[model samples]
Target chain A: MNHYIDVRTQIPRARQTINNNNIKTETEGGVPEWAIIELQGLIQMKKEDQSGPTVVGDLHYFSRNRHPVLILGHHVLNGKEVKLEQPMAVIEKDDTTSYKVKAIVKKKLLFKSRPKPIISNVSEKV
Target chain B: MDTCPERSSEDVRKIIKTAKLHESELTEVTQILRFPDPSKQNDNLKLMLLDDNLLKEIEGGNQLIFKGDPDENAVLCTSSKTYDIKEAETSNSLLLVPELLFAASTGLDETIVNKSVEGDSDSSFDKSNTSLNKSADSDDGKPPREIVHKDIISTFFTYYELKPCKPRLSKLIKLLDPTKYRGPELEYAVDKSKLYNYEALFDQIQASKAELDEELIKIQAIKIDDHYRLLEFDYEFRVLSHMLDLIEENSWPLDRISKDVTIDSLKDLVPESILEAMFGFYSSESAVDDGIQYYQYKQDKVCQFLARVLLKSAGKFNLTEFLQAWRDSVPEGMTTDESLLSGIALIDKTTTPQVVWGFAESDLPEDINQRFKVLFQTKAKWTVDEISPYIQLYATEKLNVNALLTKYARASTQDGVRVFSAKHMK
Candidate 1:
């Protein structure tokens, strides 16, 4: 009837992962921490019936720039690196009370602007 | 591009090689050729608001817990703070990208590539376009381009946002009702399971362990035989009244009351631990003389308890008479003020004799509307000062006492004093 979620147990595991000198990023031992890709509204799949796997869009960066561009069909979405007002920690609820932090994402990839069509695709090709 | 869909394929892009341009469509950006992960990760996943304090707690390896009964809403807790967990919905969809490099990481030396490059931009085109070899120019730039190989793991539309809240401890009072500590002799008659220890109560109550412990002490709950239990009011009054008599009989100054002496005298009435806990509850350390801790009896606390004992059975007392009896009832050198009676009792100034009634705030209904309804029913109108304490318990960080009143009650100025009444006068 009552429950208490324990986040303490995950701390030691997180520390253990950090202590392993060779492993720089989230490796196979743990659930890789997820960064948020915030898109305005929902990802409306064109084929609502396609079952196996859905490829929503193609995410890209022009040349070597840090700005991210997502191409959905012919529409291109231009989004910038927005620092999160408060850093977000992705917690995966395990069993009952055990919650583990996968990663703390300091920023998010926000695509709120209207998706512009690929007019730059042909024009920008070098 | 295929007419059926431009992209629908297995996401086996974990191997490190070089980038491959897909289709005749020309673009210069490095593509993150990815697919939805077949394994579902959204069902059990939930996002939490992390402030700096909470971030430090997670990093410091302190215990953070979420507590709730099956019927009650959940609350999150750190070692010393209690917070309400509210599932806030967002209009935007947040996609979960596991092991995806951030903007800061774009400059890093190591990068993962999807396919290999063998020649210049023109010679690298593979004519046969299956799912595997959908490639054109591989080496468009100097360094072999890196394409991210990862799953769009999940998406979130809502998150559990936390705001600091008072521990919902009214639930504890209910749970310990059946297991009141009458005395040591009747210990076996009481169900030990019902009298929950800290861990057990922690599971049942929507509160942090520290807050729970504080409330237990506030209500004079003492751990008897390993389980925390509230003392029966009548029995508590009896022991406290006896303890009060010792103050006059011994003529000990309030500040110099000895802990050892008090416990030694009351040891026969109840367990020494219970007396010690009560002493700690009613007194604060004033000084330590030769290692013996001297405490000042809390005037406000003692007066309030004494007044409750007087008012509990009397129900209603003439304002002047009640004040007189309360003053006489309290111990020497301790002053009793009307302000101390804020939540416990109310004076009906509108009445001819102005009778005072015992109306404990905790005993009132928890719901906001119901609480207002009862308050208005008891008295047709209440001044802002009179109504605030009763209603402030329902106030949250997002909504304060004023906001709560604006939503639920009708306010009007009477004799230049703003008074609150039920919204619907009928």
Candidate 2:
């Protein structure tokens, strides 16, 4: 059994700026506001994992206190490309749950830009 | 004018000091006080005027000198000529004590001085009524009257922080001026009662300016605009200067510049970028986010903003004391506490045990550990199967019900039934 879930958290990003010909670094921005991170994917529970309520063949979503596992929206990935409605990380709950499941997206739609017209009339016709 | 029997040289000097008489005016008044009247040939006049020669000589300068002077005579003397002593005494003007000068100069009645000096108990009410009548009678559309600088300062011990503020001084002039201090007709008329108090106010302003001059000598003044300027490189000065501009632009009177004035009210007057900079100047982003938005603003911005306003408006308010009071009175992290408490209360009141236990079982083990022990505990012991519904029903996240129960309660096996008791100690 597989289930879908959403996880939201904050991700730290390095922002750079130049001050008086010197590079300045900052951990946080000048003003603080809420940041929402979204993750969506199919989760399959491990058979041996017994910490929480997951049973074998059951899929679940997970969020953690402190880890930035993946930022998987439109950016390139190695090995196999699995397309998701939103970015998600493959959470290996335990060694038994780790399976060599390959996800190859036929078409990567998240990073897809606006498609150009097939034909264009150059004449200035209203 | 009745001859002042108790008048001494010290008394004469005090009048000079209080009125701030010039050198020549001093000479003239001295001669008048020291000389005896020659016009009165009576024995009483002879006894009073011990020095008849000096009296004759002073009588030569002006015919206004009286044989009998009032106990404390405050003569209004212009540079060229003195107003008739008889005329001054007979006029509706209040006796000019150094403190009363501002009141007289501003065209405000002496009643305020009387009210201030004598407690507002009873007599002042009558005096105020008379003052109102006087103001009504004297309501000619003229500019506020001028007074000497010495008259504006009060004799009491007080200090003004922003005394020499040019913008404030100009605004004050406008506020006191009968022609410019426009308001509702009733208010305008009522304020006119203080016309006699203008001289005292002017004296205060002048004293403030003098103090400001002394203070300015130690600091640098940077002109920021046509009407505004910075007096020091310090952050306090910067904030104060900006605050003064806001008060002036808004026409907030000294009494109206209170701490209750909201930061939102200043939104249009002060830019958000400056507020952000000021906030950043003292606090970090995370510190601000850890509290409620409004509480953050008050804790961070209230002092700098209020100090400036109070200094400009009331000419007082110690910054440290104000801040300490604010901290002591306001609870820390109240907003966060309120939010957490409300959330817990809502859930506890509306939700069932099964739902709460499921949430606890799934992702909030710690929360359940804290709340469930207090909420579900009773004298009777509950079996594992009896409590299983609460832990498993509506639970989406994977959780071990048996293992989690051991964390908060004591489990015992009796007659094939495993029972859990919250009060059972390990």
Best by lDDT: 1
True contacts kept of 2: 0.00
TM-score of 2: 0.14
Per-residue lDDT tens digits of candidate 1, residues B1-426?
311223322221111112232421222324453445445545655677778887666655566776665456667778788877666678888887776666555532112112224333342224222324434233233344344445666778877677788888887889889999887888779876566887777777777778887888777788877888888887788777877778887888888888788889889987888787778778888898888888888889899988888889856899999999999999878899999998899998877898998998987898877888999898877887788889987888888888888889998888998888889978
Top candidate on TM-score is 1
TM-score of chain A of each: 0.61, 0.15
Q: What lDDT score goes with residue A57 in model 2?
A: 11
lDDT, residue B33, candidate 1: 33
lDDT of 2 by residue, B139-215 (tens): 23322222121111101111101101111122233333342221122233443344423233323231233333433
Q: How many backbone clashes does candidate 1 have?
A: 3
Clash numbers, per candidate:
3, 32
Query: What pairs collide in candidate 1?
Result: A5-A97, A6-A97, B18-B115
Q: Candidate 1: where is the Cα deviation over 4 Å?
A: A1-33, A40-58, A63-65, A71-76, A113-126, B1-31, B36-43, B88-92, B107-144, B287-291, B349-354, B397-403
Model 2 residue runs over 4 Å out of place are A1-126, B1-366, B393-398, B423-426
